[model samples]
Target chain A: MSENKRTEVDQLGEFGLIERITKDVEINHKSTVKGIGDDAAVIDCGDDYMVVSTDMLLEGIHFDLSFMPLQHLGYKAIAVNVSDIAAMNALPEQVTVSIAITNRFSVEAIDMIYQGIKAACKNYNVDLVGGDTTSSRSGLVISVSVTGRVAKDKIVYRSGAKKGDILCLSGDIGGAYMGLQVLLREKKVYESNPEMQPKLDDYEYIVGRQLRPEARTDVIHDLREIGIVPTSMIDVSDGVASEIMHICKASGVGAAIYEQKLPVDQRTFDACHEFKIPSVTPGLNGGEDYELLFTIDQEDFKKVEKNPNIYFIGYIDEAESGARMVTVGDQIVPISAQGFKHF
Target chain B: MSENKRTEVDQLGEFGLIERITKDVEINHKSTVKGIGDDAAVIDCGDDYMVVSTDMLLEGIHFDLSFMPLQHLGYKAIAVNVSDIAAMNALPEQVTVSIAITNRFSVEAIDMIYQGIKAACKNYNVDLVGGDTTSSRSGLVISVSVTGRVAKDKIVYRSGAKKGDILCLSGDIGGAYMGLQVLLREKKVYESNPEMQPKLDDYEYIVGRQLRPEARTDVIHDLREIGIVPTSMIDVSDGVASEIMHICKASGVGAAIYEQKLPVDQRTFDACHEFKIPSVTPGLNGGEDYELLFTIDQEDFKKVEKNPNIYFIGYIDEAESGARMVTVGDQIVPISAQGFKHF
Candidate 1:
């Protein structure tokens, strides 16, 4: 009721706000094996552990509907949540989607969205178990919650990394971010001149990376096939730098990544050049990649060393060293998280 | 992209729309015991069954901040989701809450919401394990997903009722609906005259019903103590009439509720009279009661016949009879579901 002191949400940031909210929460249920802070919460089932995670996407902040097809939007919603489950080394079994839209959207529009949702459901082999659909006063809001399962011995967390573990990435980074830039530029051009046809053919790969991202469950399957379990794992949602910092803080270890080892597709690199931005900047700080950033034991590195899809980027180190990156010119600099600022 | 045939969502209604969306879904997991068309999705958890449900609430549609305090709003959101778990005769173990808010909210305001959420977590014995926090372009949106567990034999669904079963009510109904009316009236008064303070003391009982309704977990415990497993069950979220119709349709039976047997709080009855609305209207169609409506075999009725909180309001009949209500004047009227129209 008092207006004397009002602190903006941006001041605390997303993580800061989450920490404040979870600080006082007490776990009363014995079945809750893990709570808060992890990619997903782990619950004790009879034969295995259940992993649950949820994410909320808002219009304007998370996506621009102007250039985004409803079908891709629906598919991306499921993929993002599934990526969280994949981060825990778990197989997602079910997902619940809740969407709020205004009357401006027609029933046909909703069907297109579901067409994409059903496609993702089949692709990931996860059932559309339950959801809630309601009306919103303004823009669209999509919230998805997914549940997954993993063997008790195979469950992984962000706190499992060791000092000598090898850090690896599932796929290339920054393509999604570069794709967004291209789309925004094209949108501006189309808005300024109605007759201008958007030139997007050359940027197809990057645009597809942004419009439709995959969860990397295949990579999880590959690791299982090779008899390797990630020591620590996290989804590369908020870029490699921010995710690395999270792994470091949770595992109580530092990391040193090499700039040259970072994976950036050729198309993404060219787009970066055209946009007048450094490729490494987008690779390190661009969010929404939905790739997996994980660390495996050094002894198991030989098993996946030759894998084409997996790239070795860094190694875990003592906590005192902090998280840093070595430049191409032999300069060492501390990594700062400049991820997406929703506020 | 053709605008020739745009169908309004309100035409299909919420249930119709859900049916349209879920009609083509294919269940791909053996662990999924039940999907959609239930209070929650039931999944096989080896020794037991896990039930999952999700609900979304938006500002201006679900609640108005003018009369609905943020603390109570947070508490109600969790309670409503937990009620769905209770509907399936399960014990909730964990919940994930995802919220999106605009910059208009302050740190203190967020803390208040979390305080209420934590309080509900303690009361329900459920853990706040995971959640997502992000910025919204407009009003606040809260989406809560809850997972609960029940013994495989005790898991109840809406499709298990049989002819000659007795219909039972967990507690008083129509209070929450009347409560909303009182709040809306008081809100309008305050809006017209800014200096007018809301006179809510006399209507505290009903107003609290709207703002802080509790899930009927107590009733579930009572049923368990008496060795009773409801043949069919549902939460009284969308009024008694809508829920009964759901049970009849799912179970392939008919039900006849007695108007005189409907339970109403004295305060709610008095308020309804003052508002010049029939008491039966809110009792039969008023929603958000969060009470459990269930059916039991007539042979098992004696076990809970004397329970104080349980009221016997109706009986199951042959499907050909159709769902109806017997008025106090000895007239029978068919029931229609004019439930909450969020669209």
Candidate 2:
């Protein structure tokens, strides 16, 4: 119990800690085609590969129950896990949810959470196959594990991108970040004056974006329909810039994204202005968007060129070039990912 | 939020709550062969069936860190999930462990937990595939999801026992329950007087059972080697009486177990005597044993009859007979399952 060295967890960071824990892990199963360091692990299941991913959400760390409805929290739990599956170009088939709750929650509260879970299951066409529910000593803890399948040749990875591949983003970013700002502001106002009705009518879009973000399964479907699998794929759960760096590092390539091309919703921009936060900052650093960030070969761009939801932001480059962002004013700056400091 | 109804979760109980939440769930995937009702969810994996199970353990609710070592806690987490897989007569191939911790834990403490996890993974021959590590507001929470495979025909379910099947017990039971009692007593002593050393030397057997229960994979191996698949099977996680009821309900049959036939280690019996708790009570209701309970066709009993580690406890009966226990004094008593009430 008495060790001279005591290093804080924050010192290692999330990814670094993961690397340290998994460093010595050796895959003993032949069916395990891939393990760790990916959106989902791949297991060879004869005709196709089974993809597995798990996520744990703690109350105060992952969400604030004050503004986040139990139903939306439940839906987001499933959606976020499914986003991992979608990131691997897999179709989610089953999910297992495990929750630990304290007595402060009523049976009705649990039902509301399940309602949201069921809604997400229906929306994603995934089955709620199994789960565990237990009592917690404190706040709620929700952990979800999703299983998905992809054709052997169709699976995508963050390490698959090549130089000159066009970077594509599905839908706008920063909405969820702006939504969180609005929710926090409203919460503060409500705390200051309990009788005052919080103004939320105009911030509905951004707030909804934060509370009920959906997995970009539509983009996965669109790619499948067009028969063009992305060279590299990742879900933007940790913001665009961080995910871009992940793809670049894993693919041993470089990325150049245009700030002017970064998609931002009108409502999100307005909220960002009101909050006195730079709109682009949220787009680059705001998380929980659940959008798909991917790279496709330049030749295949024509197939999705007219798609309104897909935005071409930039292109891949040689590894020596490193990751950079071209500002709206035409100045290029090195892009550094400031991921969420949950620890 | 107020509908004039407030039913506490304790009223529904853990199993009842699970049934209530899963009552209206509809499975949408063809790959999902069995959902929500077995030791693990069964999925179609082409030539074989894949069984998946997940469990979550919170700090205070599941284990007290004051007496439970971090390493043993990590090992127990994986072992318990693997026990669910073993209950389905499957060999676990991979597991995903998601953990949430507060800043109170040092990096070294986290490593100790992972060290135990890695040890269990090595012992069980399962790979650590994927997991999520995040921050918690308070205590540590570990959620493990395991995937195992079994030949389609060899997969065992709790619903397969027929009348006259001989009930079999693997290794021993009630030891873990006694172990917990000893640990709690020692913890109380240590708390009151920090200078006092825990008198756990004589309680080693029971204490070890509580701290480091192993999944009965050896029993599964023996059964496979002997070419004898049980008619029905489940892990003795929630004590023998509760598991007996599960089998009877699922298989539409009743059971009759002999109290004298129940296996209790000498140390466990001694601890039970000292604590003044009936030895039979722990055998019937003491949980966390992690032993395999199964029913084999009467004809197959001869194969395991001479196996020293296996014990013949009882036999399956007609549904109309009802579940009962033949006491040591020859008096018959109806059995009731008082499972762990974590809720």
Candidate 3:
């Protein structure tokens, strides 16, 4: 606005631009318990707290329609927002989905997308509440906002971890990232030779991970059942390394995760080998995993110690140490974030 | 999905498509008081009801940056969503804005948008909560989700009006639409003659109406203060005729509105005359006016009778009468809906 000064968005990156934009915001309501820092915004609604989270998924930038099924895209849009609510250890109750689409889509095609949305809502036990449907000039864009509830005492934030806390991850990582790789590869092959069918039979597991990643609402429920609220929580959206950095930065503590303890599915490793990617690179930096990466206090660690689904791979340390990974070769290397780079 | 059968979206139109999509939607949560078909979804949160609404605005469809300042675009985006909250007679508490921008946008350009967002939040007494920032493949896209609270007894729906109820309209109409016409004319003129500056001085009022329309939150507040709640209410987003049809269809009644009673600003009339638009046509079907249309009981009419801001436009009648408009020449004509046709 000031004459001819132009600073490209990528120069600041997504996180930096967000910080710069929201710096001068002022909260005006007493019900707003939390604003723009956590996975979801927290609002105090008297008896319980309501947590709200939103996500916007655009075609091309977030998905390639050639390989990403419309149904899966719709389901993933809902799941992505639900995952944010799960990160706060909350129960999602309602969601609003707004979609903008080009006229290239037919009613049946849109219905297929809604079928997936309905399936996801039923799976997550959340009601589809309200939304806006409009015309778009380009590719499809789906934005979902979810509202959930948590008891006053059971809320978890990303800034609650302390020194000596245990870092935990749910299930395995890199499958979704590798799944995208497989899809992209198959797409390129199909483009060159239309006669060649996609060789997705052997890559079903990884492909499924990419097409329909589920939110960790089940883990949130399991944690509540175990009566152990995580000290800090975040979803592994941008892989393990970036998630570790977020936990470290938010809690003002450092973490040391062991590469040897990192969980990997056989199918994921196979896809990684096929793609010729480094052993730990996809596991550390590959994104869209949607797995929960949380920290639990040492005293409560015994509760989840025997849980097979939760993988304990690290410990929180002093802030000065920073975030680092202990490799299988017994080397300590600082973890770097290769977070969302859509800009 | 059914073999070769393809139903084009435009065949159903926007409203028909919405009805088709939400027809079989199942509400899975008791907390979901009301879902689609209203201004905002109502969720029961303890003693009061929490209302949520979402809107997606694309560059070419909802706005054009050439004439629409980024700051006003940001302001209008939030205002549009907030208007839905006001339509439900709720006080907005917080809002989350998700934006997708291309690299063509500078940090300063984005900051201008946020500055307007922050300004609107301050003006509307709402807090800036959470949002997503991502790179758009094409033009800018802004999706905003707003959450507001209304007392259980104070929550009004479009289906509450009864026969004999007085239809009330807030302020005026058609200014925003006329303002848009003026701007578009100016844009065309500028396109042909680049050196000619836009002649927007005389049309400032109508131009502002188009660029930055305000939601009728004041009327909601005044109604609350007066201890009078309308039986039903809706906002004029897709023309007053469409809103009348919606209220009639939902309430299962009819109405006879008077064209002589329709309120119009002086500048709006001037612009309408300049554009050669027929009298009363713009008032009936001009969209994006963001004014409240409600029906009040005759017993409570005296409460708002002295209020100059409130205009008595019509009265509810028997269901068989349908919705008709009484012309200034004393002719009766059916009010037809020219609603959102984005598809």
Candidate 4:
């Protein structure tokens, strides 16, 4: 720590910080097929390639308990990590969940959280393996790491796409972001008027998206069954824009996504309109979607072209072209990431 | 969740809490051979078994950053998780670390912590495969999970011990606890007078023991090399007394540990004496020893009898006899566990 070299994390942003931090990391093990720059790290474990990914959720920083139920919070933690494994086109086999809670939580409260965790495990067919439960000085903290397995040939990474690949997205986006908007608005309303009930009935779909987002494991299975191999893949965690940028930088190819092709749910668009937020903004940069963003060879495009669930939104191009979006007015514009900032 | 049946975690203690929490857990995956009740969960990955263990370190709850360096905290976090794998008689191959830090932490501070993590991974020959870094609302929190592998025949569990098995403890104990006392004392002295240079030179070994403890993986390697298998094993993260109780309960046996045979470092003994704490109490009840406690077949005792690092402290007996200890003064006392309570 030199006195003159204090680098603020904000100046570098999350991606920049990760780049600086992982720059010197060396993979010494023969089994470690991949280290960073992927949805999950890949390890060659004899018969199968093990995929490992981790996620940490912090109170206040990541979620507000006033809007987030403990059970949903627990499920979301597991889902997010599982989503990472799904991005690698792997089947999640085991997960470890570590939580730190303050004394304000009772034994029953903890059990409620575990109940959701157990439910998620059963739903995803993953075994809850090992973890640490400890006391926290302040708020709740949950960190979950999941391990999955895939055949060596089936594994996908963020750095495998080439120029002329088609960018595909699994399912819709912006619902979770819109759901967060509704929750925050309701919270503010409730805070001001203690007697009022949150009007969540009308926004159930979007709210559900925020509270209980499922990992795109189904899409991974579908891809496998359809015999489609993703050239490059990542989860839409930070946002479509940021994640596409990640794919572009890692795969050394630019992408041109069409804004008109973006799949924003009806409820999501209505919620955005109701909240006075730009309709396209939520789909483009609002995060926590957990959808799969992948690139496929142009030859295999026809296989998924008619699939209702799969949306073709972009095409890979030369690196010098940069990541951009083709708008409805037939104008091409550069895509700049405005993902959630914690700092 | 019934209102009439509120179970407090403190009443159950840590192990009791664990048992209560995991009692109803159902393993849904055929790959998951073992979920809980061991140092690491075992998943049958076709040709080999993958063992996973997780550990969490919280600020104030786990350690005081005033005297503990970020690097040592990082090192200890990895070492503790590795110790769990060693307890399973497995070799750690990969690790995922998740960290939450407030903006108060500079990139340099985070780098120091990662430096320690990197050093530990290098020392243990494990790959730093994946991790998550996020902003924390309060203090720094680090959670690490390691995956290891062991032969099916050689994997040790806590329920495998038989009556008359010789109990062995690796290396010395109580040094970490004594080191903590010294650090606390220095902190108090520094608090009282800002300009005072609190003495720490003489207590280097004990203080180092508290700040940075190594896992007893060497003992595991030695035992494997000697073709001696521990019937039951656990890491002494809690006090030796508490861990022995766990082994006895799991194995359905009684233990007779001799007080005179307990291993204690000279510096630890001196520190205990200086602090006017019972010398035997520190050796038996002090936590963070990071030593391996195991029971071996009596036939295998001769192989380790000449080993300097291994100390034969007791023997297993029938369950009806209960866990008891023979004092140096020739008094037979029933064993009591006053384990470290993180809550």
Candidate 5:
């Protein structure tokens, strides 16, 4: 960098910066079927397509250890990576976890973390293959990389959606975000009164959602069992509104979601009401829901119509129509969300 | 953890902790062929085996920004990961890099780092497939994961060595460690005298080894062309003695290295003299020299005998003898080195 020429990263935003940096990257191998723009990179591995996904969780950035338990943090790290693999319609077979932590942490503390990691590995049926562990000078950082395989014909990408496809969601949203708010509120209460025991019984469900989220790999299995492949799919890491926009943009189509059809659990709704937050806003714009956001052909609706877990929220439209939402009061509005901005 | 029980991480050491943590990990998938130990994890990918390796570099733990350039750091991260794949006798095809940095980094700063990453990707013929970028509360952190493939019959593990295997090394060692000493000394001189410039002209070769060490992947290609597979192999990351011991323990054999045959470049030798360090100490105990250390059967020695880059350094010994070194004075002594300890 020149002495006088420096541009702040925020000017380009995260997506824009990634686009500019990766735009010129050249692919050198034929095995690399997909690169740079999806839940995972797809590699052609003979009879099947191998998918690789990576995620990094930093202390004070992705989680606060004061409230987040070490075991839960480890489980969440694996779950998030497995979520990406599930998004590709693949079965995660192996994972590599690399962690850097300060000496302030004890071996027992690290064991607690690995106990959580081992539990997640067992739950997801993924082998803990390899990883590098080293000491850190600051907060703990955990980075996990997962590899999975899918039949070549069964692979899914975010660019496969078409007009008239039905948009679907696996489960409820906004619980993770609302759960974080409840934890923060309780933490503040305890910080002020040393003798006060935390009253967490009422917020158990939401808090559990925030602390430990299971990747929706079971949904991928269900889709395969029902013989229904999603036209396009992406795991909701950033919020529903942003994910809808991503699918629409990638597929060169548009989406119109119905607010009344949005799934919000009763606990999440009650918490949002008590917190004075708009009930629908968290589902549309909140983060870390880790649910499946996918599209399927309208003809395949019968296969999922009887399924209680999957919710039909909307439909894909023409490219020029843009991402939008139909309110409960019967009005169409364009959807724009300030997706989670870490920068 | 119990309220009254806690074990400090230092007591168990890195390897002991890893062993205890992964001891009960049961493999759930048949695709996972190897896990937890070795330079890279091996996965059965039908006709061939896919290898996965991961590494994490923390700012204050692995590097110092004051002396290490961001571009070189990026290049080194890729090189080290590639080295792990080469140790498994696989051809690296794809890599994913995840980084966390504070807002203090400029767009240009990140661009510089990517420039080096792209350059290394091009140099090594590996594709940069995908990665995650996030904000950090403290300093910069980079974690890289690489995937490679090798034929099932061609892959070599650290436990494949025989009693008569000849030990060999690719290229020189100790240059990187000496170069680091030179840089640190110059940094101190500059810190004490603002107007003084770093005298790096006389130490360019060693300094380059420090800043931009290349993975000896060409040797892997050379071995393939010569139709010879190593009995066992590992990269010299924690110095040669430590890596030799790893192979010995894993292979259930011992090694006898010749002190006179140790390779040290002229600049590294001069720097070691200036630094008041024994010439052989850095080669034995200093770190970060990414050279290949392997064992070849005696019958295959004729193939690499004419290869200038492959230096015959030692021979495999009986397990009862342990790892030993033969000095120039004709005395043999057991070799024990204090490897790089991050904690």
Candidate 6:
């Protein structure tokens, strides 16, 4: 309703936008150790802290059916919510999904969505305990809620990072974002000329990252095996720079990340260069990576440093220092979040 | 996309269409003792069967800001989901809400919604455990999931009725339906001329029924106090006739509801007459009454036989008899669902 209204969501992107909206939220529940900065919300249950997280995927906002299959959407829905639980350093046990679809979809379409749901359930060792199915006047709406458990002492929160904790990232970053670029480019090409087939075979890795990103529950198990518990943890749904800043802000600390240490997959690098987008931009702000970012005490670094899966990106620092990113040339640059702006 | 073009939902009215679409869902979860028939879905969770229920309200679909206050919308959202839990003869414990709104909604709007949610939580003695706040492209969307607890033995499903069980309604019906009528009328009057007052003062009872209908959780308490566990239970959401058919189909029994014993408030009766609508028709099929309807065993009859709040409207019978209605003048006629259709 603004008179001079030309503020498009593209201006802030996705990660930048989420930060702006969630900036003012304050957690009031003692049980809620962490809220909104992680893959899942952490709560203090009696026996163990429970991790609760929810995600809503609007049809056009979060996905495109022309390229993203229905089954994968269902799978991704559960996976994203599960990723939230994993970010809390917990194992997901149960989930509830609510979907609203138009009549344009047939029973077969629903079955396919369920097939993806069942597959995800099997893959993650979770129970599809409950959900609601209703008709949507427009496009499909999928909302999922996941619950997981972790020992009270073992639960990780975004606000627990200390000045000297080592920052660790599980798996690579920006592959999903790069994959989305590839998919969008191919779609544009196909739209321009129907006879042109998408050259997707060359971009399989990045494409798969966009289509079926996995939640890193295995990392939680591996962390336990290596006797390393993160002091603070969050999932990389909104890229590393944004997530790191989230931990810094919530924990009342600062973070400094070395750009050269960021784990970027070869395919993502190739795709980013092909698309003419700055590789660092995608690595820092492209959302939906679904990787784990955590901070561990300096002593715990020895346990996970040798693990190929864990990348040592940076370290937590005093709050007054502020969050920053060190470029490849050793110059520290202030980080800016271009979080996904769904509005 | 069907070639045989059907009328749009807006033409059918929200309630009318919802009733039509939800008519044929088959409940398959044995844990789900009851599904859409009740205010909430009932689950057989070990020592205590849990109640699970969800409600999704799209901004344009379910409410309008021109008239509906955000606080009330939040309260109604929780109340509706909680009512589903109460319908299963359970006490609600926790809830998860997922909200999607455009940037047009301020942080203050979000806070107001949370304020209402917190108020409902305190009033219902439930926990504001978890939720998701995300961006919406078009309108606001709120989806709530509630979890409630009831003893395994006390938990009731819609499919538990048997021959000779008494059919009872917890409170008067049709008030909400009439209240909606009054609000709609006022909304139209105001739309036609912006200066017109809503004139809701004289129609407080009906308007309250429409805007702030209460879930009959107290009825569950009363049943416990009198030691009268109903043979079957369901929340009156889609009206009496539709819910009765659902119970009958699920329990594989038939019922005969007496017309004379149907409870209708004086105001509701007067409103129905004023609108030239049959009073019994609205009482029979008007949805959103938020009353508890259940079947009780003959042995427990003595416990609630004299309770003024309870209305003994009918009795369950053999499946072969089919569901029917006994007219005030003694004619027995087959009962048909004339409930709200939401699709």
Q: What is candidate 2's CA lDDT for residue A322?
A: 94
Candidate 5, residue B213: Cα displacement in angstroms equals 0.7
Question: TM-score of model 5 relative to the true fold?
Answer: 0.98
**Could you give candidate 1's per-residue lDDT for residues A103-173 as a string of tens digits?**
99888889888998989999999999999999999999889999999999999999999899999999999
Clashes of 2: 0
Q: After superposition, which runs of candidate 1 have C-alpha atoms over 4 Å from their true positions?
A: A1-4, B1-4
Model 2, B1-343: lDDT tens per residue? 5755778888888888899999999998999999999999999998999999999999988888888899999999999999999999999999999999989999999999999999999999999999999988899999999999999999999999999999999978899988888888888899999999999999989999988999988888889999999999999888899999999999999999999999998888999999999999889999999999999999998888999999999999999988899999999999999875431
- What tens-digit string does per-residue lDDT give for candidate 3 at A1-343? 4667888887888888988988888987899999999999999987899999999999989988998888898899999999999999998999999999999999989998999999999999999999999999999999999999999899999999999999999989989888888888899999999999999999999889888999999999899899999999999888889988988998999999999888888889988887889758778988888999999999998898899999999999999999999999999999999874431
Worst 10 residues of 2 chain A by lDDT: A334-343
How is the predicted docking of candidate 4 categorized under the CAPRI scheme? medium
TM-score of chain B of each: 0.98, 0.98, 0.98, 0.96, 0.97, 0.88
Tens digit per residue, CA lDDT, model 5, B197-264: 99999999998998899987898999999999999999888899999999999999999999999888
Which of the two candidates, 1 or 4, achieves a greater lDDT against the reference?
1
Q: If both were scored by DockQ, which would come out higher, candidate 3 or candidate 4?
A: 3
Residue B156 alpha-carbon offset, candidate 2, angstroms: 0.5
lDDT of 5 by residue, A1-343 (tens): 4756988888988888889789999998998999999999999888999999999999988998879999999999999999999999998999999998888898888988998998999999999998988899999999999999999999999999999999999999999889988888888898999688778899998899889998999999999999999999999999999999899888999889999999999999999999999988889988888999999998899999999999999999898999999999999999996685431
Query: Which pairs in model 5 have colliding backbones?
Result: none
Docking class of 5: high
lDDT for each residue of candidate 4 in B194-240, tens digit (9 for 90 to 100): 79886999999989888999988888789899998899999998889
Model 1: lDDT of residue B87: 98
Of the true contacts between chains A and B, what fraction does model 2 have? 0.87
Q: Which ten-residue region of model 6 chain A has the weakest summed lDDT? A: A2-11
iRMS, candidate 4, in Å: value is 1.6
TM-score of 1: 0.98
DockQ (Cα-based) for each candidate:
0.82, 0.87, 0.89, 0.69, 0.86, 0.22
lDDT of 1 by residue, B267-343 (tens): 99999999999999989999999999999999998999888999999999999999999999989999998785431
lDDT of 2 at B265: 88
List the pairs of residues colliding in candidate 4: none
Quantify all predictions' global Cα lDDT against the true fold.
0.93, 0.93, 0.91, 0.88, 0.91, 0.79
Which tens-of-lDDT digit does each residue in B1-343 have in candidate 6?
Answer: 6434455444554445444444443343344454444555554444566566777877655666666778878888888888878877788877777888777876556656767776777778766656676667677788988777788787777878999999999999988888888888888999999999988887888878877777778888899999988888888878999889988988999999999999999999989988899898879988888888899999999999999999999999999999999988999989887767542
TM-score of 4: 0.97
